[model samples]
Target: KLLSVGALTLDTILRVETLPVHQGKFIASDGLQIASGMATSAACAAHRLGAEVSLWASAGDDAVADQL
Candidate 1:
């Protein structure tokens, strides 16, 4: 059996976007977000190896908790 804990860091990927400079604003050409966590990854890997897994994480107010 495997156990996991902690919240996954939700990422906001930006493509073809530049950092703001001198109050200049930049736009992202594309963006991709993923719901991933340390525990989740571990559990998934364990599951693939034919093992039972469990996760115990502290989630935020967003639906990320339920999603996990």
Candidate 2:
């Protein structure tokens, strides 16, 4: 089994045709939101590779943590 210990963070990804050069309103064609961080990501990868994985991430007791 793999034990991953680190921070677990919530991430947001947006798909856009192009990056804006100037500050302006923008719209996303698609997007994904997920919980990811160095160790958490590693744990996920290990699990996908058929290994038993566990994650030990530090998180605050709040909405963000609940989402994780």
Candidate 3:
């Protein structure tokens, strides 16, 4: 078994043809959300390799936290 301790965050990935320069307004071609963080990612990788993994992280009492 593996234990990981650190921040657990929701990684928002975006695919864009061109990065916004002015930054007034921009749009992404695609986007995705995934569980991410130093320890969290490590834990997931270990789990995929057939190891039992546990992640110890904290979240706030909000919608984003609920998602985590």
Candidate 4:
């Protein structure tokens, strides 16, 4: 068994057409949101190795926490 400990974060990634030279409102052509952390990665690896894995991260009560 493995106990993984680390942070859980909500990450946002945005893709734009071009770099901006000045301050202006821009549109994102694409975007992605992912919940990831070091502990999660380790837990996955352990599971792949046939080890029982557990995540011991704190996810406060909230909508985003549910996603995590």
Candidate 5:
């Protein structure tokens, strides 16, 4: 099975020590969300399932596109 379609996004996630309490404050970011593209996720899953997969995605820059 091969998946070849949909949008790709670079997810930016922040892990705050707690919910924002003030206008100006700082929190510790434990991790960042990334590559949460639905289709791309699926394609990667398919590949892991032992299927040849190719992802077809639309991105701003080719460099970013290549990451997909």
Candidate 6:
């Protein structure tokens, strides 16, 4: 088993053709929402490698936390 305890965050990853270099807005071709943060990601990786993993982290009592 693998146990991890630390921060858990929601990652908003974007894929774009190029990053903006000026003071202007840009749009992404694609985007992804993923469960992230050090311990959280490690636990996921361990689970993928066939380990029984557990992650201990705190989340807020809001819609965002609900998504996590």
Order the candidates by TM-score, highest first — what do you get? 6, 2, 3, 4, 5, 1
Give the per-residue lDDT of model 3 (tens digit) for 1-68: 89999988989999988877775766788999998999999999999999999899997789888999
TM, every model: 0.55, 0.85, 0.85, 0.69, 0.65, 0.87
The lDDT ranking, best first, is 2, 6, 3, 4, 5, 1
Cα lDDT listed for each candidate: 0.71, 0.92, 0.89, 0.86, 0.77, 0.91
lDDT (tens digit, per residue) of candidate 4 on 1-68: 88999877778889999988999999999999887778887888889989998888887899989887
* Cα error, candidate 6, residue 26 (Å): 0.8
Highest lDDT among the candidates is held by which one?
A: 2
Model 2 ranges with Cα > 4 A deviation = none
lDDT of 6 by residue, 1-68 (tens): 87899998999999979877887777889999998999998998899999999889998899889999
For 2-57, candidate 1 gives per-residue lDDT tens digits of 77776566656778655665675577889887666777677777889999888776
* True-structure RMSD, every candidate: 3.4, 1.3, 1.4, 2.3, 2.8, 1.2
Model 2, 21-65: lDDT tens per residue? 999999999999898999999999999999998899887899988
| Model 6 pairs in collision | none
Which digits, one per residue and each the tens of the lDDT, describe model 5 over residues 1-68?
A: 57569978877677887788778877666876578588878887888889999888878776655664
* TM-score computed on alpha carbons, candidate 5: 0.65
Candidate 1 Cα misplacement greater than 4 A, ranges: 17-24, 48-50, 63-68
lDDT of 2 at 64: 85
The residue pairs in collision within model 3 are none
When summed lDDT is taken over every stretch of 10 residues in candidate 3, the lowest stretch is 19-28
For model 4, what is the alpha-carbon lDDT of residue 22? 98
Those runs of model 3 whose alpha carbons end farther than 4 Å from true positions after fitting are: 21-24
Give each model's clash number: 0, 0, 0, 0, 0, 0
- Superposed by TM-score, candidate 3 places the C-alpha of residue 1 at a distance from the truth, in angstroms, of 0.8
lDDT at 57, model 3:
92
Candidate 1 lDDT (Cα, 0 to 1): 0.71
Winner by TM-score: 6
